[model samples]
Target chain A: MPLDLPNPTDLAVPGFIVLMLAEMIYGRMSGRAVYEGKDTLTSLLMGTGSVVAGLIPAGLGYGAAYYIWSEWRLFDLGHAWWVFVVAFVLDDLAYYWVHRFGHRMRWMWAAHVIHHSSQHYNLSTALRQTWTGKLTPGFIFALPLAFLGFEPAIIAFVSGINLIYQFWIHTEAIDRMPRWFEAVMNTPSHHRVHHATNPDYLDANYAGVFIIWDKMFGTFIPEDKANNPCRYGLVHDLGTFNPLRVAVHEWVGIVRDMWHAKGLKNKLMFLIGPPGWTPDGSRMTSDMIKEDWKRRQAVKEAAPANIAAE
Target chain B: MSLLQLLGSVIAVFIVAAIARWLFPVRFRLEDAHLHRELERVYPDLEPEEILIDRAGNAALLRLSGARGIVVVRRLGDKAVLRHWMPGTKVTATRTPTGLMLDTDDFTEPKIVLDLDAEGVSRTESWLALLAAPDGHAHAA
Candidate 1:
């Protein structure tokens, strides 16, 4: 059944622009937000490229999703107000898992890394959408929703709202929200940690709309900016402003690693292993990096204690 | 995505980026103190002995204090990244007519070119010698 719903993301475009302009003005006066011309341009172009990619190649994802929904659905969950609510919650849960995989699995990270390529976090940084997300298996998480008989059109609409909700959380302007809000929702504070490269903050806070998902799982890390400041970007920061490079650099990395890898097993691991995986452990994954920091902290603390005992 | 929408988005990209550039005119300049702070932030507890900056002050090499390697800092745009080039890491530091160029065995930063003058070139000669030895590891205090 063709639902006559307009894409909510499309309608929100003007709001995104206006909010960005407002944020820029606020950043100018308050010094809370950071903006660089080249960074903003790169991010916006990525967003535009994402739209284009969705229109052209993303048909495969949309097609597959609806196929499962129409033919394989358990029940014909017709349009209802409550269906939207159920779709929103279930889709968010799916997002949590998919997003977790996006960070953990190398194949998915190739598609997702564009959003994290920026060294600075602000409203513009939120505009850095993935260009090749349709190619990856990230959409598989949403397929269950389709199977559960939620219309793909409805899923599409709510998922758009999920994304829209996330945009405002990309700023540094707002500190902590109200204590109640902070506990329940993913605020700018929580999302900042998600973007940070700081060892302690890496591979954490993968929430779309609700911070509770992260808390329910073990992925939540509170924003501790006092002790350790957030340094945004990937482990190996891309030092280029070219949106093309930003979009496909990780995909290139995966191919390069696979070609150089020794055995077929190792090559497969290069694709499936966590980002920064190596056979000899020459490179540090996020987990390894975090462990290194913990080890360093222990050594530093132990040194003083040893001296005091002596 | 309509043709009109796509064209409008392209135009908006320029307008937004321009507005950002206008508001934040000056990117973070790499002064010695600022560079020191940034290096410390990236590499916690790794103290640098000397900060060797180029004439342009765009790029710098921090000779680690009582350590086995140098930390390289290069500007991306307004932001700079601090990467460690430790001993046993194959960093081919050679002097060219242009400047002292380093072929770093790093995925992100494959090559590093340090713009240098005559005096700068002469000073980097020692760095070339230190990094080029068969051992290729300089243990300094």
Candidate 2:
């Protein structure tokens, strides 16, 4: 047989649609709104673009992995069930780092910001993806799995599986899963915290398949419903619904900042720094935003008691 | 996938998407409690319970009891910009054939227009009355 190299995501397209419809139905029956027309269309368009834009880069990434496996692999870990399992775990770990870096680093964030542009979180929001991730160095994160002697094909397969597992978590239909399952796996609740832009929920729960990574890394934050209902989207909102603008808005922001920057150091910092970081102390990072919110909240909390004492 | 298969997948995806849109629709739910909670968070001193929120939460309009100023919270993506309309704030709340137009001092371009129903118009009138008052927090409406 000719070396069958088919994208696994292609096979999952039908299933994705079915689950989206199911989620919409469940949401309606449960009296929680899950879908918006323009938002859904925008998300779908982003996904379509991401997949198409990803083609050449995906080939390059796979080729690099294959080259390493063939010429420079550390071990000849042959095609065994355990090897596949190991590859799966390693691929997931790679995904976690790629995702984290996508958030932290400005260049990666320019691509990743498209995913976070949607205000409403739903099945379609899962479809909201980055058209420019291919241009970024994100694929380098997965090269380790291939270098560890797993075939590039196997790595690609497991990566697809990882993505499919993550798809269901991008939803509001299913609340908290079983306590044990929620503790172990990345549930919808955990993912909701990841998607939330609220002060408490910002930059927490960056897990792909396992919640263990977030917990181990100390980035885990539980969903708090009583105090703060999860507000989805970026801190500074993208005021436009145009899909093209949504895709390139952050990239444009990065360019603008770099162009206005005084020196080479500042221009480079604009590319490598965090999303909200500026050369000057004007803009706030997620850390700064969270700290400011905490201080304000503390003041607000103490005000009534202080007044009473007075 | 072949060209035919690709076309088929596209058609199927759109079909499903269309169904989802039809089922859910895009109507912003302006819950009284939710609005009150949000308002209190922003303006802690203002009476959240006494505040009136329009049912059409598209362009959320608010009027506090005995307060001359109106609060218009515009939803942009996930983040909302809460525009405070004090007595001194150069903001005009006019009723158009389509809905209510809020021309404010903050944003000059792409004016704030809300597709208010009859109830929303009445509520806007009640809130705008506060802006017409000479003294702040003295108006009943």
Highest DockQ: which candidate?
Answer: 1
lDDT of each: 0.86, 0.76
Error of 1 at A169 (Å): 0.3
Residue pairs of candidate 1 with colliding backbone atoms: none
lDDT of 2 by residue, A192-217 (tens): 89999887777888889988999999
Per-model TM values vs. the true structure:
0.92, 0.78
Most accurate candidate by TM-score: 1
Error of 2 at A295 (Å): 0.5
Question: Across residues A91-184, which tens digit of lDDT does each residue of candidate 1 receive?
Answer: 8899999999999999999999999999989988998999999878888899999999999999999999999999999999999999999999
Q: Fraction of native Cα contacts kept in each candidate?
A: 0.64, 0.31
Residue A136 accuracy (lDDT) in model 2:
81
Candidate closest to the true structure, highest lDDT: 1
lDDT of 1 at A222: 94
Backbone clashes counted, model 2: 0
Lowest summed-lDDT stretch of 10 residues in model 1 chain B? B130-139
